[model samples]
Target chain A: MKAEKILEALGEIDEKFIEEAMNYNMKKKFNWKPIIAVAACAAFALAAIPVANHFANNDMVDGGTTAGTVAPVPGDEVDDDVDYVAYEYSVNKGEIIGNHVVELKVSKSRGRYVIKDKLDTQKTVYLNGMEWTAKYENSWSETDYKVIVDRYTGVCNGRNMSFGVNSITGKCEFFMFKTTGDIDKTVKLTRDELYEIAYDNFLSGGYTEDPENYQLSDECSNGSAGYWFKFTRFVDGIETSEHVRIGLRNNGDLYWFVGNRIGEMKDVDVSGFDMDKIYDAIEIKVKKIYGDAYVDFEREGAVLRKRTDGSYVFDYSGHIDVKNSYGKVVQERCFLIVIMD
Target chain B: MTDETILEMLFARSEESISAIDEKYGHKCRKMALGILGNEQDAEECVNDAYLGLWNAIPPERPSSLAAFLYGVLRKLSLKKYRANTAGKRCSYYSDALDEIESTFASAETVESALEGKYLVEAMREFILTLNEENRAVFLRRYWFMESCREIAAALGTSEKNVTVRLTRTREKLRKFLEERGVEI
Candidate 1:
């Protein structure tokens, strides 16, 4: 078979697949919360500088107090309505960029944005009668400062769970919470309990995938770090490439969470096609392709995703690698799909 | 604008339909042609010709997906242009893609009955419909769209090496698929 024949045949494929490839479907809505959190960190740091200066001046004159317990007094300038411009700073470029200015809501009473010039120092402040802390980590190699404590909603054993956000995309990249005590290697929460916690957190974080579409699997529960849970998206009992992974500490605390929403998968009816014949045909085709070449079949699955035009395409059924007699990969990620209809 | 609305305008012979299509899918169509021809001037001319082709076909034919229809037409036109441009000398990018597929089955010396184009197309379509979403996207983007590996990589948010590797394996798979179905090389 000539390759041009194959190319011409490909040109005649169903329009649904052509339209599926037309748009990559990797649309990511720039999340604003993490950017707001980054801005709030900067604003709080700016708002705290004056208070710290005031405390320093008073301590120099009368030695009343120094850098400690410097609370904003009632009827002070803190009650005035003020606007703090939180510019989106590009850490990679080492400069403040973008026209998006998030207005920081500085609390008039006790929600003082407190940040210290020192590195690796955490400042605790009372906001809405809840203890909120701002922790800063300054990389000595780079001049960019990462303020990592704006969305701190949970605390385990007096430690706040911190999540790193991509400064440009504003998506929550990863969550990290290390255990301190001897409870590092213990399973404190059952799989069901972990699912409940992860599901609630997943929903609260504004992720919009249905829980029913995902098949939950406890990947690792006996590791030294914590339990690793993955929620893989599947359609017609065939797994897709999208998943959400959550890692929990032995004390039932969330230590790691990373989710991918690039390719949106949807459930479709495949009852029309005989899947057994399809798999069998695919297997035969694979063997013929490799011949005597060493083949490594990694995954046999299907992908069904909704196109931009609201049509569903269920394809990319399987993947394998073909190596030559010398054990070198001749073809990598061989994609094969068979549709009888 | 929605495809239906633009299509209605096209059906009603409104000249605004051209601008609407140019607004909605002009950049993509041009990018597709550029990926195939690898020249800005040739790609621009090819897209214009493709638009003319679309205008001529819509009155006699109503496609369910206008984007797909335009894509198919543009792909044909771009390949035609590529063949004309690379007739004497070797052009690398799109020709490289073609050669990758050619190498899959070009080595065969056996003489047998050639498979009909219709069956080959049918088998190819059936084979394509079975691919997973990402691989299908990559395959169509490279082969059908005539996009370079670099363009495919950028569009799919993957590396060029990954796209090239997938294309190689996919071409091999296509060869095996056709051969098992009694297609002679």
Candidate 2:
């Protein structure tokens, strides 16, 4: 029909349908957690630098330890006029280079000297601790430093590293951890698990390697935050590999982003099942456990749905399964209800 | 107006509610129903049915826009009635019009495809918001209220052919708008 006619028909519609639809909307209230999480993330960024300093002061360094200094060079000192080159870290490994300062956080506890960056801030690095100071040079590439340990004591690992941030390569490097064992073992997390890990990392401090490069705000106290996670997995016994990246913005909202493709869960409800085993988990439960109602399961995209008597159903979209409590798939059919409503 | 006010008046079976709706939108609703059904009796019946539906629905339902809510209900009822009455008829005007527009999507094998649930409604809302006030009113009058080209022209003080052209252009715009938002047609 003509658009105008269709609009007219829509305009002339009876009031009952509108009421019913509105009632449905009221019944299914929109989740506000994601919005609150985003707001909290913004607040955290504003107050992050000061809080880091506050914690650093309480956990202060001993006297005689070398403190690195960084300052912007005078414009008249150099004949060449270059806009301030914000230092950043490379995209490789677990480091994130940014325009201001490089930041990285390691999950596991490694040796002492191995944790410190090449900058001569301090020899000892503490967990959840940040050290910020000024550098002498105008450019990062021009400076050089070595990773040193007290030779007489011989208490820490001896791993020397140095780099410079110049106009040609204006990048600041932040190293998190060094893996000595199998890298495969370190990366074997399901998409949901990886998202949770990443989200936690972002919440604690921040990740340097994030493409979004979200930083903590100065005004943020402590609330919920969001982040993304990417992990590499070996699928087949043969030579085949795949990268699984999941976008996790809210505490419970998990979005699938495979390769270059990104979309919300189609028909799945990610509320049920363990978030850790979300990769290949199937949950089956009776919708009306003691009743005569039969449950049916349907798959849409990577999600599963459970319905009872073709009316009420539960969605298990982006969740991972750890236990198959519903019995074997080859035997009798099983159904799981993720959400009660 | 607040839904509480509407509901309070509706549940009380207040003549004021009916009078208020009639005084404000009765002619407009009648014109739209007549445009779609092409019969005065059916159009009047649709409007009365709309009132009764509104009376019954207000207690549990709170609508953001009373006019839009009423229009939506009336349209559904009108369409259902039209379908039932013309079940075995040979190409009724209302059926023909719907079929002509619906055929394009049917041929593309997307006529049966649901509009991704709420996305379709959202898209339609967005599309309506983009039109100019006059055009938006005209569009709503014709499609939502089911007013004829002649009736719309009379209401807007324009020619019937101009109304037709404007409607055609609007349809094309809507089609493109829906397609951009990933709707099949």
**Which stretches in model 2 have alpha-carbon errors above 4 Å?**
A1-341, B1-8, B15-27, B62-65, B88-108, B114-116, B183-185
Candidate 2 lDDT tens digits, B4-60: 455578778786887657644575566556656667888789999998898788857
Model 1: DockQ score? 0.20
Write down the lDDT of every candidate, Cα atoms only. 0.53, 0.39
Candidate 2 docking DockQ:
0.05
Q: Give lDDT tens digits, candidate 2, residues A142-249.
A: 111111111101111222112222212222322111112211111223334544555565444211223233322222111111224554333343322333343432
Tens-digit lDDT string for candidate 1 (A176-270): 23222321222345456667777666555433345567776744332322345677778788987767666564234464433333244354566
Fraction of the true interface contacts (Cα pairs closer than 8 Å across chains) found in each model? 0.54, 0.10
Candidate 2: residue A328 lDDT (0-100):
17
Model 2: lDDT of residue A162 = 20
Worst 10 residues of 2 chain A by lDDT: A146-155
DockQ of each: 0.20, 0.05
